[model samples]
Target: MTDRDADAALDRAADEALALFADDRRSSGDRRESHVRRPQRASDVAETVRWNVADWAAADWGGPVPQDAHAADSVSNGASNSSASDSPADGSSKGSSFNDELFNSDPFSEAASADRPAPDDRSRQPDSSPEPNRPPEPNQTTEPDQPADVPNEAPEARAHATPWRAARTAAARAAQPLPSVVRPLGEALGQTLAEPLAALTDLPSFDTSAMDGWAVAGPGPWRLPSKDATPEGTGTSTRTSTGTGTGILAGHAEAAPLSDGDAVRIATGARVPPGATAVLRSEHGKVRGEGRELYASRHITQGQDIRPRGQECRRGDALLPAGALVTPVVLGLAAAAGYDELTVTSRPRVEVLVLGDELLRAGLPHDGRIRDALGPLLGPWLRALGADVVATRHVGDDPEALHTAVSASTADVVVTTGGTAAGPVDHVHPTLRRLGAEQLVDGVQVRPGHPMLLARLAPGRYLVGLPGNPLAAVSGLLTLAEPLLRTLSARPAPPPYRARLTEAVQGHPVDTRLIPVVYQHGDRACPLRFHGPAMLRGIAAADALAVVPPGGADQGAEAEILDLPWTADGIGISADTATGTITGTGGTP
Candidate 1:
């Protein structure tokens, strides 16, 4: 069918579908009203409409609709709503872009044409003025490390401050006096080395054969003697019945020196004799004269297939510098270098306190109480970030209990979830004042976790307050705890890397937004949905957190990425197929 004919058929089908919803419609004259009315009984009209749209999209557009694309029905609804609003009182149709809009919007945004106008044409014009209360474009150029903008009518106390500066200040002030520990090699996987790894002895201490071969004294085509009639008391060594050279095993010690025309059958790694000039591989030599005699068939080159002493390293040579991470390969290398133990930086001890009266430890939400997601997640995450999580305590919103818990903890850092705000039930700030603690960071200019704070309780003790929301708490952990633990454990900061955003990220007008993103296999990053401050869906599946500036980042704009402690190394390469877990490396959510 022709394109125009197909458009007319679609319009007719949409009208029929709308007619079916007449019983649920509002009064006829409310042009701008678009929502379906509440039905007295359960109905399937919405489902029918969605299926119809999906069918039409597939058949007319020559593309299959993504089964999980929930936005398809919404696009159809928008077009229907536009048609309804454009209808005249006399029942005449007004020209509209409904068909054009529907045909152009692709379910996967990457496949959509940039030049194609949006369903709402106003969005396509850069010069179009935004609504007065609407946020500005996220790609606005801003100075480095500047605070995000505050709303014009916002109170002075609500000024959005720089988060990076706050993190730096907290880290600089977070110091611990714990002594280094000598740990067995097997126990030093995640720990940073406190001293250089030096070789105890020279590698390959003696000259050896590099391959299974014959150690020869000189030129080839040499003959071996027959064992026929030599005097029994003669001053000559015994030989094999075939008169081949005596075979030398790898660990044979006290091997006699070779004369100018002699050859010794030597294995790989076997020590060469004092007077041996070269080693000829087994494949290069031949036996002749039946079983009584043998001859070296190939010409011999001096010093071939011989491993000289101390080829890898000399005794006392430094192998690994201090502060190196003791990974599996490092462990093997240390063992080869004769180190039984490693001196590693001490892990900073941290105690966690989860505060909230309306939190349940397990099960689905009931009676307005939510499951305690942070309690189960934070401990392991902190350990992954190099903190020794000593204990985790769940204390309800009781100020006295909170105060006691904070006072009794002997850990280097106390991480408290919730109770940092100024609400009546939020007792963290007031309790800090009562205990005469100094607040290092009051608030950060980051979204979802802006209420996070850091305080110093004593010379070597610290308190970090994280927001109660599951995802917000994660932001706080990375923003405050990561740096603090890194400093306390004396681990060096990782080098910075940035990824170009594959899609535009909406930025807060004044606050830097820490967006949950998965690095695509293409090496760019794409933002995930469901990343609201209270939601954990995005962060749970993210490979890294994109540090968006106040104005946000545009498609293809480079943004700094904060790697997650557990999965950063395998971001785009690792896959957990059993559970179908995506590692934020461009996999689908």
Candidate 2:
């Protein structure tokens, strides 16, 4: 059936189910408006029921859904208590409510079971093709223990939010670009250009020699002035009796005009003298008779070894447009094009607040206190991610101190590590509540870092709360902080890339999984060990995070990869592909 037809069918089915429920409710004297006043728990259950009905309706028509949706259906369908109303007045209603029946009695199942196709009916069946934009139904199994139609429990059911979706939402909300600023070319590295880099004047500005050669007016057998020669009929050596002005060095100006058949010694990058037809290599042109005569052994072309004006670019040419990333090479080009400074999108100034009193600043972990890993890691990582981290302060779990620090800070982004959860010392949420901060992302479905969050502290300022675990914090950084920073800095998103998984990666039943992976030969991504949310070993050695979809990916399956900022920009990590270990000046990531 076409998608339109299926949608129509589902709509009709929904109307019929609602009508049946209306009749049942009327018979039981249950007011529909009572649902609105139900307790929060009951309201949640009712919503789940509605979702389950929608699932069965979709399933009856054979539409596939994402695992998260499917798991919700399973939870709803397993509810044996089929009561539309749980009021004290209606103490018992043994029969299934219309709502419950919709979830339990799938219409397609009944139709298929009650009317097995007759031999004659089967012969007359028409050929069918899948409707456009309609996903083919997954093959269902009928295992007695766990029916094929029943979906597995979703991993997301236990988590607070989905990682990628939350990140995208945060980026969309903070879509405004930061203020622009003019910075010296050297300081503009890693910034996004706010204006096009146009050449001030034509490159070269004049015809110049491409190499150290003789500037010739015409074909060789050209004669040089006897003053440029020695008296003994031998060519002038490096030590010439002639003045320095006689031979052209690079940056030579006020050069004597060349006449027809005249040759002058020239150096690389020296402007060709006016009236010169071409340049001949010093070795190619034989200087004889005390340099009085120069003979070209090989024929010379008009433009050979000469760089004409505007060879690289014409005057006022746009070398790079706005929104381009200012790399070292771009800075060099801007400098060469006569640009002393560049107008670039300003970096969001970020202040990192490392929470948790349990975190130790130095020395190995003694007692229960572990060394503060994020304090050292976040500042540099934030810089690489295009934020200027103003300060990284260790704000212990004191609520008053955290509040004071946050209220006083003026940075565009406030990154708080740990204390996102509602534990005894978790003051981030309370502080944000006290400050009236707007929550953007409260938590994520990602493993090892489900407690990560994003909040808007003030206009043009945000707070990204990362879980205390090291690896989980890393996940939150990439998932939330990176996208937000990129948007604020007006940097374009990097194009998506995918690679085959060299090994199997266990997937979250519903949510997406981001696993630390090193890219291998043959464009394959190898999942690293020690990938627990608390462990940093895998991410430290990883090249990128392979985004495995809801269902686990088998070996050789294609997986989308999220490249770490350092991987693409060559920040701290120097990746040795052969050894599959990344090294940096200060060590690994």
**Which candidate should be chosen as best, given lDDT against the real structure?**
2
Top candidate on TM-score is: 2
Off by over 4 Å in 2: 1-160, 227-246, 571-589
TM-scores, each model vs. reference = 0.66, 0.68
lDDT of 1 by residue, 517-536 (tens): 88787578777655655667
lDDT of 2: 0.65
Q: List the residue pairs that clash in candidate 1.
A: 138-551, 149-510
> What number of backbone clashes does candidate 1 have, counting pairs of residues 3 or more apart or in separate chains?
2
Whole-model lDDT for model 1 versus the true structure? 0.64
lDDT of each: 0.64, 0.65
Worst 10 residues of 2 by lDDT: 31-40
- Alpha-carbon runs more than 4 Å astray in model 1: 1-162, 176-178, 212-254, 260-273, 276-302, 569-589
